[model samples]
Target: MQGPVVTARSARPTVMTDGARRHLFNDRTVARYRHSLSEGVDRVAERISGADRPFTGMSPQRLAPEIAAIDLDQPLGDPSAALDELETVYLRDAVYFHHPRYLAHLNCPVVIPALLGEAVLSAVNSSLDTWDQSAGGTLIERRLIDWTAGRIGFGVDADGVFTSGGSQSNLQALLLAREEALTAAPAGSQLPSDRTELLPKLRIFASAAGHFSVQKSAKLLGLAPDAVITVETGADRRMRPEALERELARCRREGLPVMAVVATAGTTDFGTIDPLPAIADLCEQAGAWFHVDAAYGCGLLVSPTRRHLLEGIERARSVTVDYHKSFFQPVSSSALIVADAASLRHATYHADYLNPARMVEQRIPNQVDKSLQTTRRFDALKLWLTLRIMGADAVGALFDEVVDRAAAAHDLLAADPRFEVVTRSHLSTVVFRYLPAAGQDHERADGANLYAREALAASGEAVVAGTKVDGRHYLKFTLLNPETTLADIAQVLDLLAAHAEHHLAADERRLVRR
Candidate 1:
């Protein structure tokens, strides 16, 4: 007796009965996966080509109801239908970072090769925690870390792990510093055997212009309210080494152990780099761990012309680099690299079922041993592919172009009587404010600048960031897109000026009515 033939048509009913079996990514569904991804790519490309600006200025109040209406429990079943629904809820109003006019934040336009890596990694779904889970992935990430450490001028002892972003990197770096401080405390001197008791006396020194993550990390580490001591910045917005020296001396006199001295390589608003060589000297004298938060300025590591800007970064005990910010990789591509590989042992925890002591004895590699996260994504693949396809020099060239563009934008703002430019940046950000008129008071100017930023976003012509400078409102343009031209900067400035003037006129009319 011959068995009934099992054809492709008969397998469809079984798959449909199982409901989601057909969607599983396997050899049998390879064609479906390819088709689905191609459809998505087409939709995104179409959206990008049609977009005229960086944003549609869609507000939460308007879009929230549309999203809430969707019943997630009810599957659309067809990929095409779900994508169509996505168009209305997401794709339509999504902020297009790739657009040249997106000057809002540290978000950079992604590169194609990195995007390719992203697709591949997501499909593979490899967890980077253990060698068994991500064999080649673990080695790939380690190699990329070594490559980055070499760029930062670290020696063979360097090691690191990929992180979600700069904040996590900073947190992990500080955690290591905290441990080192507790373990290395002097013999007698008021330092208690209980590390928890000493946490309050551990001080972290950072520039006033430094990232807020320093304070947040301290809180997460269970430090006192005043653990993060803010050192004043100079006229250039860089941390004043003289002020830092004074603070360190005061901490020493008070018997407060200096846990770390964080130097900013690229401040968020000012884009100024703290004097690294001077700060490194101070850290060494104080016996404090030196950590450089080069999240925004890490691009200079590969920069062909601006590498000199990050001169003292190599001296740091640990450094944070966000490839997403400077290297044009996608979101969540950052690393915390250390000068001494053994320091990462501070983050290690051996799980019996996972990375046990026996595995370490066998010399098995596990990324979780050096990471704050256990189930980490293989984000290093993005940077690997990016470097493989574009080369370091090409990436550096793109960053150099943006820095040159920023300098030109600064000059443009300075020459314009309608605007007041702040201190020039060493990186690729320009901070300025629209000056209403000669007679306008500080309060009115602040209001005008504030109103202009909001109005500009509403108008959807361009998106720019806003920050406070010396208690006054200022507009910021973070130039990460290499495609942005001088003409685009000029046009955005003109629009901002026009909006500010209108705001001032409206205020005058309301005051007259009163």
Candidate 2:
């Protein structure tokens, strides 16, 4: 009897009840979750502040073993414990984009207001597809879209929808353009009854330096790979208006319909803005849809001192703006605005259970009517929160700061004999490459610069991007961080030079051995 006596024990998690739903209405459980989230945010903030480098470069060969050790199939039971493990597995080796030395790519250090919006929107779980799902979120998103259209000086009929990013925006814009072209075709001309028949005659024109998304969009839209016409660019890397005109004429002569003329507000590699006015004029004359991919340069919309850079953007039939890039907001914030809101009707697909035509007639604004996405995230809130707190002018000032910093970096690189810099930056990117000794061959110089970039990234002291300009490897410093300074650029340049020297000497040693 004494041996049979049992002791008190803690209760285990039960499988009899809905474990997921149990936490939903429980204040204690939510409080615990909140605490865990707060702890996680603090841990990340502390880790970033304490970090010495932008990244801890762990090659896949080395990282594989470490990643293999993690048993992702098992859950930790407690959020804090899970977060601690995540810190070891992810946060430790993660690239700190906020770090001044992180000069790679278009990633920017986000503003605090946007982060707050992210938290709120995540908690609320607003699906912005319909008014029934998102309620005020749909309205807020529409308001933000309207504000952006106004900034672009679009007409009263202008309208837009939030997209995942610039790529999605560009895709949706081209889809609309494709539909418009089909609708405008002459009565007896080669208007196809079938989808495949239209692929050959439809062409899109963009500068050589334009984002790769244009070509990718063509392929995705069932157009042939050669459907994208690469317009020649000037020495400054801006798309040449005369070249575009000739290409448009050639398309006309060949009986190929120019579906769209995609002008660049900001080319990715060179940060070049094309001759938008001339391009827009030509597109108007040719009866082609004018689309401005302003994903990189849309920040000029709010730029008080530099807004003139986007003088002819208002004439665009469609425009893409990535707030995530230029607005310093968090990722997943972009919009596709059209000069004529009626064009969005092309994307409208009404589901009986969701946004039906009756709802539209009743004046219930469902975003799905205009959006390519159904269950879309409320990314517009990020920019809304950003503009609300920071003010548009403040955001523009921040952009101005980085752009001015880019000019300074360009100057520094231009003056340095050890590096060969491209033309002055039109935005916050400086493309340059390490110049080996004067007598070195182009291949050797390319090898040095390529090796130097890898070495710099491997060292974790600095992170820079690389591109092939004119088939020669060139290193790039995408200066998106406003806090990054001339001194920081100097240090990065010095490190790059040191790495280039090492690679150059190693090459010499290899030649000697041979």
What lDDT would candidate 2 get against the real structure?
Answer: 0.90
Count of residue pairs whose backbone atoms collide, per candidate:
0, 0
TM-score of each: 0.96, 0.95
Per-model root-mean-square deviation over C-alphas: 3.6, 5.2
**Candidate with the greatest lDDT versus the true structure:** 1
Clashing residue pairs found in predicted model 1: none
Model 2: CA > 4 A from native: 1-28, 188-196
- The list of candidate 1 runs beyond 4 A from truth reads 1-17
The Cα local distance difference test for each model comes to 0.94, 0.90
Query: Distance from true position, residue 177, model 2, in Å?
Result: 0.5
Query: What is the per-residue lDDT of model 1 for residues 395-447, given as tens digits with 9 covering 90 to 100?
Result: 99999999999999999999999999999999999999988788867679999
Tell how far residue 97 is off in model 1, in angstroms: 0.9
